[model samples]
Target: MVNTKYARVLDHPESSIRWDQESPLTMTVETREGEIETRYGRFVGGPADGVEVVEIDTGVMRVVVLPTRGMSIWKIESKGIRFGFDSPIAGPIHPSLVPIDDPSGLGFLEGFDELVVRCGLESNGAPEHDEHGNLVYPVHGRIANLPADALSIEYDEASGRLELIGEVMEARWFAKRLRLKSRLRVRAGSYRVYLLDDVTNELSKPATMQLLYHINIGSPVLDDGAVLEAPIEELAPRDELSAGEIDEWNQFGAPQDNYVERVYFTKLCVDDSNETTTMVRSGDGSCGLAVTHNVNHLPYFILWKNTAAKSDGYVVGMEPATNFPNKRSFETEQDRLVTIEPGETKSFRLSLLPLINEQAVNKTSERIKSLSETFEATVHRQPKAGWSDMS
Candidate 1:
């Protein structure tokens, strides 16, 4: 059996090693199924300049992780298919270039081009202003824009398991002190990627937090006739525009000019193990993507559809989050926010599986159908009271 190996790529508080593309750090290991390789490098120019990335090749899949940007996933490539949207903004824009604190509170969009990005530690929703009209929290919070303080790669050749670990801290004087420890894991020859995250309250006082995983997909997998399948317990349109087309909430169409976005909030049914699966399949049901997470940890789900012109970001989001992406004040009033005392930690787990063939897609769809049979779904044509800001 081959032994396990570990390498530290960055340690902000200790080491001062500056990484760049000129000379990258690389590692390779042979597994029973195939070779697993990892490369650590920095982007050279453009909006992504100076950003550090770690690319992992698990034989069957290629994933890029951005250590310089809260360890968010840049993209995933499986069987010649890319699972990412073509954002108008040429990103992975460096965090330095993102004006996250702009008065408009929409500065987060400046660097919003990732297949998977975390939205929280404190807040993860619309921007909120105080009674005095001063911005209290910016859009989507600040977790995604924060860089990891430490990063490491661990590989177990015997089991063909590889893990990219990162630690990001969101702390300041007289403010919330939180730390996010994230691990992205994959196995040799596997199309599924797993994420495990732990948010810890490092301060001596109690803290409130919110977290949401914004998983976006586009193009080939999100074109006309694509559909979202989930064992939904309850579903509600986020607004009147979305309510008007509630019947088409699960369906996708060809990109259209001047297309408006719609959002659906839902509570998903869980299996015996408290796990739930949500999928987006191609028009012919030939291939797709699946997101699986435990409902116990993430009780709410949000579907964001923006099928605008291709150049204007024709994409969809399958988000499994702790709560709906409402303003922090609103979520807190609804008791959807999480609170942790000093030295406390809360954990979350999720997996992404790329369906590379027709059989895989069909199998996943069947599983969701079976789950659906166990629970009756409630579909609300309009925004449900207590679930939406407008409501």
Candidate 2:
């Protein structure tokens, strides 16, 4: 059994330190003796102060957790493969410490370069004051920057699975009360990572809720010939820049100077499993990454592509959202906002799996192709089934 009693401050080797702090990490101090292990630590220095990182390895997959950022998975590695974008800006920056007037979303952007980043419990759009006339919500909402109030890490020896749990509360004495409880798990000798989230309303009144799984993919897995495949019923460009190159939405461009970002909103059709999937693979077809999510909870998909100068960063985001990231007011006008009544809870599930070889890539490609065809339901409607990466 794991024990928090063993937690302590851990210093980094001089050559291995990434931050300016002398000894910025504090974690549940434990020695690795098995193939599956979990560790939690924090940076005690300047920008990264109070930022906690948890590492979990299930022999086949290794994941880094950012507890300070709503338990976002910062990195995923396995079999010498890296599936996430490496942003020029590294480490976590608390949103509360950043100014809300910054239009570039710099505060949230600093940590946006991760494998997975949750968008919202209240809002995930452009900055604006709430309908109740409160101050504006920073870019992507407050959950990402709000540190988890409680955290636990455990390994199931019987199942050879590693689990990480984090609880974050977004409550002001008089405003909306909401709690986001996230549970993430990975199994031994498996190439998949699972996320199951539950968001509950603790207020006496109904509250607006919006969420998006921002899965960013870049170099290695994403290349010139890489394609974004999904059973898209229709596609619309977010702006004229995207409309200009709508024909090539599925293709990627070489990194360039002063490149403008383009976004496309796709209405997808799910398979019999009631799950929608999006994939990106290298031109060589040797490797790829596929993300599958419950379309019932997250029905919208946004493709955010930015192939700017190397220094600026290059990435493509395969985002699954409850609604498009326009202004909250705009989404309200469209009646797309998800409402959570008092004491009610909503569940969401998604899986990230690496396509290690061409066979795996081809299998995913075929599955996506089949999604466009008709298929009869064979299995019962199972909500938790989305946790399985095989989908």
Best by lDDT: 1
Question: What TM-score fits each model?
Answer: 0.93, 0.84
RMSD list, candidates in order:
5.6, 7.8
- Model 2, 172-209: lDDT tens digits are 88788889999897776778899999999999998888
How many clashes in each structure? 0, 1
Computed on alpha carbons, the lDDT of every model, listed in order, comes to: 0.87, 0.73
Candidate 2 clash total? 1
- Model 1 clash tally, residue pairs: 0
Alpha-carbon lDDT of model 1: 0.87
lDDT of 2 at 162: 63
Model 2: residue 378 alpha-carbon error in angstroms: 27
Q: What is the lDDT, from 0 to 100, of the residue 6 in candidate 1?
A: 30
Off by over 4 Å in 1: 1-25
